[model samples]
Target: MTVALMWEARAVAGRGADLLAWARAQHLAGTPLRRETFRAPQDRVLVITWWDAAYDADLPELPEPDGTLVGRPVHRWRFEAVD
Candidate 1:
């Protein structure tokens, strides 16, 4: 099965670039299949990750920045292959 995990996080003051860099490093370390970022009108950042079973097994816990702003909440969606 394939799973797409959508993680929404608020960009902390002076931390947006750092957060993005960390995410990029994680992707390069083989954590997720593909990663994409989107910005809302309110400046909220949304990150989407696509992963397979293997990728899921290698998933890592996200880092939390001290005194950083967080998004409304975290949400996830799962999908399976159909034929």
Candidate 2:
């Protein structure tokens, strides 16, 4: 089974671009089977990474970006494939 890791963050006012750039440059360990990013209306950046492992497996996750760039702490979710 595969697991998906979803990480999200909101940037400070007028800093969305910088936050997106920083997210684009990030590299998570385990060499994800697939990775994607999204931007929301409220200056939010969302990153979803698919890995070939169980949800409980120990895998490298996207590290937190500098606190100065974000309005609040990063958010994360983990999901296991259903099938």
TM-score of each: 0.54, 0.95
Count of clashes in candidate 2: 0
Candidate 1 structure, TM-score to reference: 0.54
lDDT of 1 by residue, 2-73 (tens): 666666555555566655655445434456666787765443556777767643454543444334544344
Expressed as tens digits, the lDDT of each residue in 1-83 for candidate 2 is: 89999999999988999999999998765698999999998789999999899879998788898989999999999999996
What is the RMSD, in Å, between candidate 2 and the native fold over all Cα? Answer: 0.8
| CA RMSD per model (angstroms) | 4.0, 0.8
Reference-based lDDT, each prediction:
0.55, 0.91
Clashing residue pair totals per candidate (backbone < 3 A):
0, 0
Which candidate wins on TM-score? 2
Q: Candidate 1, clashing residue pairs?
A: none
